[model samples]
Target: MMKFRHLRYFVAVAEELNFTHAAERLNMAQPPLSQQTKQMEDDLGTILIERGSRPMRLTRAGGAMLEHATRIW
Candidate 1:
């Protein structure tokens, strides 16, 4: 089951595309934010963001998930 915390983390990271900024927005550390995102991907069984890429882009699945998440929230 997916958690709301995971969704929140994903949304922050998705919007910022920078772990540091996202973490700051969440008032947490970058590592935890990254870990939460990893856990979310593991639960969903797919890659979300393309880490280490310039101007990070979401995977197709990530894009779809983001859209749904937005509506659900």
Candidate 2:
């Protein structure tokens, strides 16, 4: 089961594309935000964020998730 908190975290990170910025926006710390994002990806069984990129990039699955998440809110 997918949690809304995870979805919200994903949406935040997806929109900002920066862990620090997303964390700031969420009023949390970067490490935990990054961890949650990774956990979410793991739980979903897909790589949502491309960690190798400088600013970070979203996988196709992440993009689709963002699209759906935006519509949800």
Q: What is the alpha-carbon RMSD of candidate 2 to the true structure?
A: 1.0
- Please report how far candidate 2 places residue 3 from its true position, in Å: 1.1
Task: Give the per-residue Cα lDDT of candidate 2 at 29.
Answer: 94
**Each candidate's lDDT (Cα)?**
0.89, 0.90
Model 2 misplaced stretches (Cα beyond 4 Å): none
For every candidate in turn, the CA RMSD to the true structure comes to 0.8, 1.0
Q: What lDDT does candidate 1 reach at residue 44?
A: 92
- Predicted structure 1: lDDT: 0.89
Q: Tens-digit lDDT track for model 2 on 1-73?
A: 6788888999999999998999999999999988888888888899998999986899999999999998886
Q: What TM-score would every model get versus the actual structure?
A: 0.94, 0.92
TM-score of 2: 0.92
Q: Write the per-residue lDDT of candidate 1 for residues 1-73, one digit (tens) a residue.
A: 7899888889888888888899999999999899889999999999999997988889999988888887777
